[model samples]
Target: MSFASLGLNQTLLDAVAEQGYNAPTPIQTEAIPAILEGLDVMAGAQTGTGKTAAFALPILQFLSAQTRDSSGKISVRALILTPTRELAQQVHASVVKYGAQTDLRAALVYGGASINTQIESLKAGVDIVVATPGRLIDLMYKRAVDLSQVEYMVFDEADRMLDMGFMDEIQRILKVLPSTRQTLLFSATFDDEIFKLSKALLKTPKLIEVDARNTASIQVEQRVYAVDEDRKRELISYLIGSQNWQQVLIFTRTKLGADALAKEMCKDGLKTQAIHGDKSQGARERALEEFREGKTRVLVATDLAARGLDIEELKYVVNYELPFKAEDYIHRIGRTGRAGGTGLAISLVCEDENYLLQEVETKLETQLPQQWLPGFEPDLTREVKKAPRRNSRGAQKQRARERALGKKPTKRRR
Candidate 1:
């Protein structure tokens, strides 16, 4: 349905329309109404699903309808906690954009910036505060900000926060917040840990899931290349140059690898930059800005910078190194194929990562077609065997019985 039918204020609707959003996305369609109803919500939707606007719009509406404090001091009524500085800034931007015509004031506070400036902004007062967990906790410890009156709280990218090891900080923050406030938890995927945390944090929450796990976006065309470990960089360079690809994202496993790859690509006359946690905030922001503006042809990033990266028309994603966890493979490729747009995801697999690839294929419930470069075919005589699959107790007993009966045991394909 059209965003106009979502009961958004005319000014907010105008803002959305100006942004060229004619219809609500699935996550937005389900989340906006539940949020407006003041119910706790837990949403499972991938990045680039307009999840930010889902909660941002409703929070803006709620804050606008409230009466200002008698002292004319704008105490924060809503707190949005995000995992990364980039995601925090993005959510803050949406809040400001949608609340531009209203009386609400929003501010973004995160690390890698001067705490003095954030403290000054807190003193000036704000209606909504978007922050990272660490910096928010620091501010609260110094009594620089108060959340006792916070009416709404949001944990955007909840799984990412958990991955970053912010569980203690999250619990501490929750302890300080008012128990009567409305809560919302939005994540790309749900695991046992996230489910347990949701049970503790939400009160009979409305559940919204737009896609099932193990389902990658259909808009993405995925391919895998079997290459030697040493030839991966050469193959990547050749592919980009041969295809004249612009705006490609390359993922590496470590910060050093990301930096080295970007440097080598630059040496090959391609504009490139590396973004990771080690880089200063300004450097990271500049790199992202250049990449978004199409000034940089390639951006090499580690896993930390990979999550919550929203780049429009991102044509290609290359997995320079496969993650150890199979689930992360899904997230890596998900950087592309955004917003129902066609994209490509390419993975470079070496001998060492063969088992990782098999695990990933099993998790996806589909076998990936492996392609060999004309001159890069691996040696079949090497006999590289993966570790044997683990068997359950019942399966082991059945296998023993078949062996005793002189019958071959059947293999169960994952």
Candidate 2:
């Protein structure tokens, strides 16, 4: 169906046409109507699926229907929380573009920038605020923003936004929002934590899912290579050199690993860059820009650092090292195949990481096809893990909780 059929007004439809979007994605098709009807929605879709507009349009429509708050001013009526500054900026930009035809005001707040400027912007009283949790908390403490009038709340990346790291901050924010407000939770992937948070936050919410849970995009060609952990860097450089891939995104597990791998790739005569939390925001943005512009052939990054990274036409993603979490495998590989584009995802699995691979397989409920590259054969004499996978937090917690009850916990996947 068209955007017009999704309960959007003529102005938004005109905006959509101007943006050159002919129709809504699956998530949008299902979510916009329910959200406009004032229903709490929990939506799951992969990256680059136009998730921003799914909730943004409905939010704008709801706000446009009412121009002012009880104080006869444009107070903060909607709040969109994201995990990274890049994503917050990206979402805010989309909001401005969609709401351009209307008079709705929007503000952005995140760390690593001058809070005074954001404070000044909030002084004008915006209708919507797209912010990262930490900086929003800073604004809250400084009394630079007000959220008591917030009627619509959105968690853009629920997986990372409500994880153990940000849960405390989320709790602080949730305590301030109106309890009767409509909440929208969107995530690329889901786990036990997401489910628990949804239950605690949403009230009889409409569940919207595009594909099967924990599944990657079908447009992507997935493959796994068995090589020695020590020679993974060599294999990666050889693949890029032999295949002549100019734009490839690599995933590492830590900041140090990303930096070291980037250095080695640069030494191999391949232009490379590394981005992670340890680097300044300016450095991270510069690295991303250079990589996107094809000045760098490879970019190594950790999982957290890669959130909200929007790269159009990216065709290759390499897991230089497996992540400890299985859901992260899906997120990392998701960087390549986006917006219905065809791409390739390669995972370098050594013997030590077979357990992690098994965890991913369990999460997907299917085994990834494995093959060996020429001259990079691994020693097949060693046995892979025969035990049930238990690397995820849910499994660990279940084991502990069961032990307390004098019972054995069944093995579970992420």
Candidate 3:
């Protein structure tokens, strides 16, 4: 259905049309109506599903209908909490963009920036506030902002916030918000913890699951390459150089790994940038801008920056390092194949990551096809060795010796 049929204001609808969104996505179609009805909503949607617009559009419409008191200043009526600074900035941008034609004013507050600017924004009075939990709490403790009048509350990326250990901060923020406000929780996956938290926050909520859990987008072509750990960087360079991929998103396990890989790729003549939590907010934004604007051929990042990355038509995603959790595989590959656009996801699997690959296959309920590149095929002459029994003292002694020699110690047989 069209966004106009969702009961959005004419101006808001015009704004959405200007943004090139004429029809609502499945998630948006279900969520906007429920949110406008003042019902708590629990939505399960992956990145690039236009989930931000799902809530942002209705929020602007709802706020535009209300009449503020005199002084042209109103108490914060909505608070949107996100897990990371990037996501907060993204959601805040959506708010500003969608609410451009309305009387509503919105502001974003997060760490790694000047609190004085945030304090000034709050003091000026805004209709909606998007913030990270840490900085939100800081403002609350200082009495710089009041949430007693907040009627709508949104927890964007609820699962990520919990993963980053923001449960206590979320609980604290909840305590201060009005008890009668409408609560909405949006996430990529629904784990047991998400359900438990939902039960506590929602009141007979409208549950919307637009896609199956653990399912990657059908627009993505998935493949795996078996290579040694030391050769992964070279393999990536070869793939990018030979294939001439214009914009590629590479995922690494750590910030350090991301930085090093970006540097190496740059040395290989592919313009590259790294983004992670350790980088300054400005630096992270600049790197993402460069990648999005086609100025950089590759963007390496950790999993934390994987979510909320809304690049359109990203050609490829290279998994340089597999995540420890199998579910993260879905999120990583999701960086490509967005918005019904065809894309590719390639994983560089080392022999040591066999177990991780198996776990991922089990989660996806399908075996990822393995392809051998020319001159990059794994050596079949090498035998896969089994770990020795730990019960034998000789085996333990051998393992100790291998560890002392800077080798991977053999796993103890179960």
Write one digit per residue (lDDT tens) for candidate 2, span 1-414.
Answer: 888899999989998899989989898999999998899999999988889999999999999988564776778999999999889988999999999999999999998889999999999889999999999999999999999999999999899785529999999999889999999999988778899999989999999998898798888898999998778999999999998998999998778788988999999999999999999989998999999999988999988889888898999999987777788888888887777788999999877566678778998889997789989898777666354345465565455345323467775643
Candidate 2 residue runs with Cα over 4 Å from true position: 69-72, 379-414
Task: Judging by lDDT, tell me the better candidate of 1 and 3.
Answer: 1
Identify the candidate with maximal lDDT.
2
- Cα deviation of 243 in candidate 2 (Å)? 1.0
Clashes of 2: 0
Candidate 3 overall Cα lDDT vs. reference? 0.86
- After aligning candidate 2 to the native by TM-score, how far in Å is the CA of 192 from where it should be? 2.6
CA lDDT of each prediction against the hidden true structure: 0.86, 0.88, 0.86
Alpha carbon lDDT at 329, candidate 3: 85
Error of 3 at 1 (Å): 1.9
TM per candidate comes to 0.91, 0.91, 0.92
What lDDT is obtained when candidate 1 is compared to the true structure?
A: 0.86
What's the C-alpha lDDT at position 126 in model 1? 91
